[model samples]
Target chain A: MPEEVILQAQRELPDWDGQGFSLLETPFSGVKFKRLLGRTRDTLRELLKIPDHFHILFMHGGASAQFSLVPLNLLGDSKCAAYVDSGYWSRKAIHEAHRYCQVEHAAIAEDYIHTSTNTAYCHITSNETADGLQLSLALKASTPLIVDMTSDFLVRPIDFEPIGLIYAGAQKNIGPAGLTIVIVRDDLLGRAHALTPTVLNYTYQVEAGSLVNTPLTYSIYLANLVFQWIGHQGGITSMAKRSQTRSAMIYDVIDASEGFYRCDIPPDQRSRMNLCFKLPDEPLTQLFIDHAAWSGLVNLKGHVQKGGIRASLYNAMPDAGVVALADFMHRFRKQYADL
Target chain B: MPEEVILQAQRELPDWDGQGFSLLETPFSGVKFKRLLGRTRDTLRELLKIPDHFHILFMHGGASAQFSLVPLNLLGDSKCAAYVDSGYWSRKAIHEAHRYCQVEHAAIAEDYIHTSTNTAYCHITSNETADGLQLSLALKASTPLIVDMTSDFLVRPIDFEPIGLIYAGAQKNIGPAGLTIVIVRDDLLGRAHALTPTVLNYTYQVEAGSLVNTPLTYSIYLANLVFQWIGHQGGITSMAKRSQTRSAMIYDVIDASEGFYRCDIPPDQRSRMNLCFKLPDEPLTQLFIDHAAWSGLVNLKGHVQKGGIRASLYNAMPDAGVVALADFMHRFRKQYADL
Candidate 1:
């Protein structure tokens, strides 16, 4: 979603790297496609510092698909899995896992979250986009820790030492929406249930080198561009710092408003990717959103279920945009506080 | 894949339709995205002449994913489904369906293909890409006819009266690889298995208007462009005629080669989309492919399982390409006849 990435993609749209054809026109086995696949995998590995024991797979169907695939692939003879009830996405994962195996709702605050020795894995939605909550607690689980880092994947550096698998939908911090990145430990490859579809089978995908079927070729190409852009922008450490600065700018305005605006999330649990807040009344909230749109700051509406305002500050959001939003929030609060 | 379509896409890559955001940057619920979704669905319906009783749902994953979903969504209370084993892709669909329900292999040549009154559906892969075989028979089935029209979709007009559902991966004729289009009858919406993943559930997807989870934003946008392009190119009627003319130009050389070239598929079953043929020997076949590549005709190598040359003439292929290929084939045959 970076401007440089989008520009590069547009420039190479008609003909990719002078290959005489677009990326979609070339066969997956061709040189251009092979280079794309290899470079994307390598770049992701270099960026994430993923262990050699882990296989990075480019898959389809986004994070929602992984809700079923995680339980199917990891529930090898185990009858149950432990899941942390973080928020919206975590509840969706737990609900989907119930269709495959027993889901034990556990909290990450526990000293050792794994309830039984035979539990399949410990799952958590590391960042909940809907509720603007993120997990910052150190996971103390004995079983494999599976994290859905959909909204906050590359916003910060990851420590793969305590992780078994990580899946992220690429719309937020990575690239686009159609592709899902699954980094799974090699040892957990062939544990899929018999009824698992081959497209969702981890072992088959790894064996086929993630070319089990024609992949989301365009998304992967753009994602590689994004990864390169990230590397150029000083990698995940820089992205994390920017995220903190951007979210704090908006959160500071809410904290200083003195009942003019409010954010209910605890400071420890607030998501740096998506910051949700509310104004005093529905009419004032509407006015704030309308005024923001008039000032060329769009898509500030919150998730419909929550119904207030959300400022999603992904990696692509420039710092100037956040500064503008903070400025707008201050002016809007001054105008509405006297009402 | 059309040059005009690609150029249009490239032109609008940075900012789509003056919305000041790329297609991937817009939220699914936003006005730009909703317009895209509606226009795409409408254009496809107009092109395919899809009935009012059918709901056109844009989905994730490709044809291979649908091999499992078709059965999962339509199996209902029926324990058996009839599948026609034509070739590679059909066998794949049949194999995947076996994991879910009882698969009854029935040929289209049968007078009444459905063996039981309670059979869920009759499935078929309309065109076999690997072997250049296609089903030309008018199917007679008491049950709903579910067709995997992945390769041949939009190449010809379809009769929807006898069909219950049709699904196609959009890469072939529609757009890119990540999005699949599922057109299901209104009556078959709620028949998915209890454990079916929500992403694969037809009822859930329809109710959510294919925004169930992001819905492959970029592919849908490109697919809309392709639909408009198809409309400009005189719709499916023009595509079918061009397919015949283009394939006949290649197949004529094979038939006239006497013993120098051979296409094993029966004349009636030979596909108009993919035309496969073999040279006298492996060396000659290798020479032909290399020469064709040098002449700027690439990707003529056949499937590895079926080692020969396959000329896949999709909708995007210009007639000039076929003319060049036919001319090259004639010259190559004249030169290699002495060998």
Candidate 2:
């Protein structure tokens, strides 16, 4: 019940009565943005145990932007940067890295499609949204690690020491589909490539306190609101517990099914946030998507290669929403048992 | 009356009975952006007689962003780019250009306390918001010209051939903030330095139809609404007449003040949109600002200069607002005529 409190916070968001402002442009610097950002720092620090030497920056562009930025700032005399090709985003990161410095894949997780690589900065997606894989421990690499944790932020704790940098686009589980939250070490702030745009140079924003060129002010405001929501639900320990149960509930349904439904992910590699699975056939998957849509469950269509379904249980998605989805899957399975 | 009818069109802008789906984000295919952009093109073409050879782009990051971009794409491999320093913005353009190539100033209009000078690009503000100065025409630049016509858009029919590139930060006169309307010749776009970030690359944006990434969707929506608003009011010609009348009314008061007000800049170089003037001392200016705030006429304080008052009358500021300010100025002048 305490875990369900976050949904209440999300619903009561923006607090229009007191906010003196709407979720419009310019910082509701008056109240909303500052309070929420303060709450974000507090909640994140409390949950993730961020230390004095570290900083969490709210920025625009996607993880794609950081690809070039990381090398521009981090790569010194070394001409080559490195990464692991987990999915679309990692490949995208490597493509951008090539534009700045040489890029190489240290390793690639073939079976699970999770990246296993080593290089200047070993990169991987902690939770693969498309492939439905989430790694609990740090993916070991000889080089400094840069992980894209866009889908699994705050769902679990992060090890700050081994990781040189971590960037998460705030869409999948962080917040809305804009703001990017980056946690980088203090030393990494200013070592930008001389050619880097002042706007993209992390230190420029850091020195300016992220008010660099007006920002995605509203998105940060919303993200701050969401961080507060997470804190209100007893922070990350509670969130991890709830998310574990949430992931288990859906994965259990997949496991219990006698081939009536199917999930391609090996049980060990299943994601705590995204549960990607499939129906008996392509036609059945489409039908299931339509059935789910009419019932107020949307965005259920799986990725094109992995057809079936993907249910992303982010912080905002309540346990009840998961239960409702599980219940719908059950009834639909019975309805089409003949298949 | 026709003007009033067109102003009323802004109130009915959403088309969905205020539901707001009409102005949703333009998607990747840019079908929606193209349709609205097509409408904008056809309307502007009819109104301004814009040649088909020139290109229009709807982009993110306003003229401040373009100030650097225009030079990057224009200077090519040239050692020096000439500038016309007029006010706060022209100086900014010169600074941004210095990052890329050597910059030469043809004019420092404000260095002589807003006196005119000969500068290449003759980069005038057309309307300066901070100092409230608007140049009626390009100040005779022999080389290709780039103008930051942000605060005054379409005040008159511009002979685009005379201007190589015209960029506007939309918030002031065109629409809401975050969108920049860049009208550049087709040849000007493709010459960006290899290091230019694709977002800031004018050539990339124009080639891609300005739907590069998920732009500031809401800002562009507001800009399209403003373009439609201008279209309904007999296009730019009508806006020019009304705006000219508004500026003339304020200038008339300043000219008649009998030494109570000291207008800056020579009469020949005076801006029609922004009539910059100063009071005898700081106390009177502070009092005017304080009084203006109390009367709900905000943003009138002079930008951190010694001390003065600046009133920015963009397209959104109704004529009645100017009249009210003019009326206040008349009262203030008469009451303190002894000063």
Candidate 3:
């Protein structure tokens, strides 16, 4: 989503690697495609500091696919798993897991950690996009932790020691929507259920080096550019700092608005990726959205499930964009306070 | 894969619809993205002449994923489906279907039709890429026919009345690799197995209008462009004519080679999309491949399973490419015939 990535892709769209053909025209088996795949994996490993024991897979079907795949692949002989009830995404994972195994619902992260040790794995949605909440604590537990990092991946350094697997849909902060990135520990490779679809089988995919089927080659190519851009912009540490500053700029205005603007989420649990808040009334919320769009700030409407204002500051968002949003928020609060 | 599509996409990569953001950065819910999805579906429906009773679903994970999905969705209560074992792709579809239902393996197209009427459905791969064989017969059967038309999808007009469903991976004649196109009858919507992964559940996808989970927006966008290109090139009729002309140029050389070059597929069954052949020996085959690449006609190597020389002339292949390959083939045969 970076400008450099898009511009470079545009420049090379017609001829990739001087091959005299569009990259879309070539199959994944082409030498240049193979090299591009290797470079993408290498750059991702460097950016995430992925351990050698982990397999980084570029797959299709996004994070929703992984909700089913996690339980199907990791359940092993144990028919039970623990899933934290964080928000909408967590509920989806839990709902899908029920069709495969017995799912124990844990109200919080600590409850999942204290879940019966006999469970196969514990699951959490590290950042809930709809509810605008994020788990801020680092988890260490005997059971492998499987995190849906779809909304927060690549925004900060990760501690992968206790993670059995982490899957992120690339659309949020990585690259495109069709591609999903899965990093799984070596120990969790081959315990898929007998009926697991081959395209969703972790062992089958890893054995074929993630070429069991045709992958989203163009999406992966874009992701490779994104990984490089992140590296050039000082890696995950800088991403984390920018996210903090950007979210704080908007959150500071909401906090200073007293009762006019409200963010019900506890400050510690507020999502840095999606900051959801409510205006004084429905009319005011519509007015804010219309005025923001007039000022060239769009897509600020809240998710349908939660009807209020939601501001998402992903890695691609410029600091100036966030500053402009914050300034508009201050002006709107001042103008409407007495009305 | 058309030059026009690539060029147009490159032009819009940075500022899609003048939205000041890359298409890759927008979620499927964005107004522009929803419009793109609508336009893609409309273009596809128009290009394919899909019937009013059929639902066109854009999905992820390609036709390979649909192998399992077909059986899972259409088996109903019969739990038995007949699959024609045409070649590599057919065998794969059968193997995956075996996991979900009782698979009746038929050696050819007629065998599937003669299969018990009680069978749930019948499946076939209309074009086998590895064997360079195409099913040219028009099928009319009481049992619903499901075709894997991955390689020949957009090359010709399709008869959809007999088909319960037809799925194609977009890599070959359609657009890109990550997106799959599924056209299924209205009656085939809701029989998916209880355990079908939500992502692969056809009924769920249709209900959500293929927005069940962020459908591959960028690939679909590219496909829309490709559809427009096909329309501009005079629709499927012109594509079919071009394919015939292009393939005959190569096949004519092989037929005239006096055993110097051989294509074993019966002339009636030879694929217009992929023309597979061989030279007298392995060294000669390698020589042919090298010379073809040197002449700027690349990807002439056959699939590993069949191992000779395979020249795929999909919809995007210009007449010049096939002509160049044919001319090179003729010269190569003449130069090496006596050796």
Top DockQ: which candidate number? 3
Candidates ranked, most accurate by TM-score first: 3, 1, 2
- Model 3, span A2-83: residue lDDT tens: 7788899889989988889888887898778888999999999999899999999998899999988898889989999998
> What is the DockQ (computed on Cα atoms) for candidate 1?
0.76
**TM-score between candidate 3 and the true structure:** 0.97
lDDT of 1 by residue, A1-339 (tens): 888889988999999988787886667767778888999999999998898999999999999999988988889999899998988889999889999888887765544565677788999888888898888736668888899998998888888867889999998888778799999998888788887778879899999989998898888998999999999999988998989988998999999999788889999889998998888889888998999999999989888889899899999988899999999999988887998
lDDT value, residue B247 of candidate 2? 78
Regions of model 3 farther than 4 Å from truth: A109-112, B109-112
- lDDT per residue for candidate 2 within B165-269, as digits (tens), equals 888866556543456788877766566676565556777777777655445544554455666677777888888888778877888898898777777777766
Which scores higher on lDDT, 2 or 3? Answer: 3
The DockQ of predicted model 2 stands at 0.16
Question: Clashing residue pairs, candidate 2?
Answer: A106-A118, A107-A116, A107-A117, B106-B118, B106-B119
Model 2: which docking level applies? incorrect
Considering summed lDDT, which 10 consecutive residues are worst modelled in model 1 chain B?
A: B107-116
Candidate 3 displacement at residue A333 in angstroms: 1.8
Give the TM-score of each candidate: 0.97, 0.81, 0.97
Best of the two (1, 2) by lDDT: 1
